[model samples]
Target: MSEAYDLFVIGGGINGAGIARDAAGRGMKVLLVEKDDLASHTSSASTKLVHGGLRYLEQFEFRLVGESLREREVLLANAPHIIWPLRFVLPHVKGMRPKWMLQLGLAIYDRLGGKKTLPGSHRLDLRKAPHQAILQDSLKSGFEYADCWVEDSRLVVLTAMDAEARGATVLTRTECTALERHADSWTATLEGDGGKRTIEAACVVNAAGPWVDTVARTALGSGTPAHLRLVKGSHIIVPRAYPGDHAYIFQQPDKRIVFAIPYERDFTLIGTTDMLYEGDLDRVEISAEERAYLREAVTRYFRSGVTEEDIVSTYAGVRPLYEDKAASNSTVTRDYVFEVEAEGGAPILSVYGGKITTYRKLAEHALEKLAGHIDVPGEGWTADAPLPGGDMKDGDFAHFLWEASERHPWIPPEMLLRLARAYGTRLDIVVGEASSLEGLGEYLGGDLYEAELTYLATHEYARSAEDVLWRRSKLALHLPQDAILAVGAWFDARREAATP
Candidate 1:
């Protein structure tokens, strides 16, 4: 007999994971399946910010900005380890939007989200020490506001882990090949390492992100109306551009903004060009034009210009934005829209156009929509709930780190910080009973050890080196090439040993 579930969620991105976690918490038997790894596509490819779209105010997306701003507070409180405050310096230029407009926008942004832990926006003197040395001479002043930096893929994994902990089944590297809708349930064909099988679910949530239309067509047939405007956003990473913990928000002539954030402790992450994407969804990469565009975009502001020679790595992902008929790709609404189709048979809620900051709220809204067609039992509860390893005293990550340092003084400060930030209160699980560095199992490279990999595979559903290096953690950026190869070999050995 096929396994039965109250909810079946497709897509392992933030929205799908959040939906599964929310639904499972609401007393529903849930199963979430992802064709690839969690956050392997668009979710992992974000600019990695949790903020109210400060620029969206110009497009009058007040509701989205407000909701995102509010979510910043909720998410920060819930997951302080991965989601914390980041200050942004928005430099003002003579030809750009006037200072008064910027000031007014910041004012509205500050008030729209209501009372919050993060500080409100304020003016800055760019002629000061850090800005004078970092920015061009013509830039006399700017505005400073607060957002947050998130480990994008880690957030997805931790959310899925929480869902699993709450009794939901999370299957990674597993694809939902087909969906057969019945009046009271859905029979989905799933294919993965274990081969093919079918499972029945009372409802389905299509949070497939870039593949939303594909999944919808598979479930509702190919004639279904296409409502996705695929916009590709790309980012470039280079050796640290400037010296500071604060990030810069650069305004472009096209009225869009680009961010230059300090990444992985030793690199500057800049990016995100919005272009209409029409290529294969599975193989998205940054283009030559985008590389030059990003270089020029940052060069116009920084004292040190970014050139092609300085680029080290690049990534791109497509945002499956709801087709709002907006002329400019940059102006499409970041707010989520839902398409609930239940008239034919069982309910299938298709999600469209949402930002990472607002994913939790999107899930609540998704389940609320599903409730109209299915038996959604529990009330909204994710807002106050802490995700896996997120429970800290007063959600104070700093104090928690200090305490961890005391507990594991033998560990190096840098490695301790990385582990604590990645695992939070669950760092002990990664370390296991290792009382010293030697006990951490084989040293893979850098600060990585076999113990951490074991925890990831055992608890976090990590299957391959890419899953560990790129998504679950950014160790790939810091590890040597040989170490990277060794990680792959380790996974290969593990799989071989398990095989009959």
Candidate 2:
């Protein structure tokens, strides 16, 4: 194919995928390339809460918090399956902020963005309420509030799928090595399974997340490297340690807080140690000290208690925070920043910092910056567009699931739940006319079957077993190690057989 496109996007994270979805809907031809799989970087590694960043209230970021909170309701309406209501219990410590002040923050949160659906926050008496069941004995009071939980990595994949359906080319495992701006357009070089190819475009978007500065300096040769502050955030997964479905957020003496969230079916996600990082993004790792920090924080608040032995898995991500070094890691900004460089040719837009919760709005705002250079139809369209499988009645998945069960009466409950969450109204595509568990194809492991794998392979562009187990679904958390290896082997052989 000859070099041609209106826009060329580098990176496959949520920002890149969201931008591709937005621009394509406006009738622009887009090609998004990523060196690895989608959501392979910071996009997948998150605390997994779609809150308004209540802690940000102390940082005087009301505008950002409010805008994000508004999008929260919109996202819930858009993707109800993977994103749903979650309650959080913030155990009140004597030395922490006064009860009235904490209530003020929640009250503002509960009222911000014309609140609806979500329940308001309430003060708790640890001596009498069930919220105190998981609290350490020293704590006597607490508060309960609402936020939404998300399948972070799947959100990126769904956005890319939506973009592809809207006429954008989403390329995973494709690397953009260099670019040169001509008189009116830019030529970019990419290397991948499609072999070396050249693409021409009116503009380039560097939504490389952690690789933003590198793309600016190396590919587009912008000369001046944009400022970037990399902060390493790590999470640990442990067996469920408490009863009930609500999550817990505990305050530390340093004013930093930690979360213990119900994850998968029988696990709790405890994490996120934020420490200034100077390491290479490709080699981000959870330090032993960081693990100790997370475990210590969990132990301090949860009456069930957790130690290093309790941890089953750990993941670390490098936050591509915009360079504004603060006195502490907690003070660094989570809001996103964009820089556009036209340079007498095609404009190149670079995204610096952002979080999972604010991705959709960030995508809308980034496209707004490319007005004259990169052609867009008008305003925005993604706020109403359904993301991949998110199209359902009233954007409600529960109702869809109930109706699907009647259609496939013999299908197991496990298969039905997976289908509903991953494909929403399109569950039929995976289940088809299967009369029972056997008809769904071979069972790879817990909640994973050959039918779902084949559908992901043919439609969602899943190239490896990890794409299914880790990103597309969290089945890896339930499957045995041997079963995971078996599935990996199966996919590898299939890929080799289909090699061109």
Candidate 3:
């Protein structure tokens, strides 16, 4: 391994992974270390939407909204297969803000971004349209708007994959134990599956998400007043509750809004409560009360009610929102803040807060901020460059899917389309020279096949069956417990066979 690098990123979430990719692409030797598997933390536990935050307008956070709206378009363009358009139907309520105000917000949302391909926002009468069939009678009028949906965790992995492809060293399951400032550089102690090792870098970036302040204060011995607020957001997943393609935004009595979105191929995702989190990151779990709150919130809006029994899975994530000292967690600023600690000869750059929607721009701006401390001579190239498997023509996902279908005639249409969506042009590597379903090998669970599993294990840095089943693919959701156990056994046998 090299003794020193141009950059060292301390997390594997969206921000760190993105910065690593951008820097590596710019000819900077970079190293990214994540304590756990990539995106195992809050990056995977998001609402998984690229939105302009229509609600932010009410908080007068026009700057954040405008930036997010612009970012939404960029992200949608770069990863058209995984990041696609979503329409949200906001039903007007009796006691909430005026319709004209929502319309104004929609107008601002449309124009704030330099939109080229995705359709802009428009008004809709819920009672007069087919969407009415999905809603109750009280929702008479509403407006339909555009946003993008993303597979949040996969996006992080893809970013890391792209960084590695561009010659960045990615080390997961590596804990940053300590940092020592040497002359003109920083040496970091990292211990992972391969055991303890020391790596040196010109600059150290602390993008540890929830552990940002810990790295700054505890690890690096810098006490400059914590710049982050860890607010806990929880989400629940259930089998598809409603039969509509469009998502719903319901206004609650407390001025908070709840979203009921379509998820996966056969499930509905409802969530997210903004509550202040004052506990350990490892201990952040959805309380029974919080589950009731989410279920009740959804139950109030739609005719259907989701009880505890309906939730197939629950996840909680702590957003390291830039500390705003706001009373309501919902009112906390979603903007990011950076602190550069340059003392003597070394610099430690720390990233505080960011959203999945703005991660790309966040990375570009982050590098721009850290450029002054470290003498670097490269321009940012992330905005224009496509991510791995994402160099589609005109970013036309539909055309690409049709082409993939034509090439792989034996694969089911839905299966082919899904592969094209997830892997983009890289689907060729996953499907290989298969001419029939039998060529794909055994169906372990979900839509997973032995061919895809082998590809993931060999190419995508998948270490275990959980890495393949849970994170790489949501086969755990579709597979029975016994099946998962069998897959785990198979992975163990395969790994052992390869071991020296």
lDDT leader: 1
lDDT tens string, model 3, 1-500? 73789899999999999999988988999999999888888898888899888888888888888899888878888888789988888888777878888889888777775654568777788777566666777878888887888888788989999999999999988998988887678888888978898988999888999988888875456554656778889988999988868788878777878888998778888878888788989768988878998899887767668888999988898998888788788888888888888767688888888889888888888888888888765887887778777899999999988888888888888778767877898999998888888888987765668888788777777777777776776767778887798788878888789888
The residue-level lDDT of candidate 2 at 276 comes to: 82
lDDT winner, 2 or 3 = 2
Give the range where candidate 2 is weakest over 10 consecutive residues by summed lDDT: 218-227
RMSD of each: 0.9, 1.5, 1.7
Model 1, TM vs. native: 0.99
Candidate 1 positional error at 222, Å: 3.0
| Model 1 lDDT on a 0 to 1 scale | 0.93
Model 2, C-alpha of 147: deviation from truth (Å): 0.8
lDDT of 1 by residue, 1-56 (tens): 99999999999999999999999888899999999999999999999999998999
- The estimated TM-scores of all candidates read 0.99, 0.97, 0.96
As a whole number from 0 to 100, the lDDT of residue 12 in candidate 3 is 93
Candidate 1 ranges with C-alpha deviation above 4 Å: 223-226
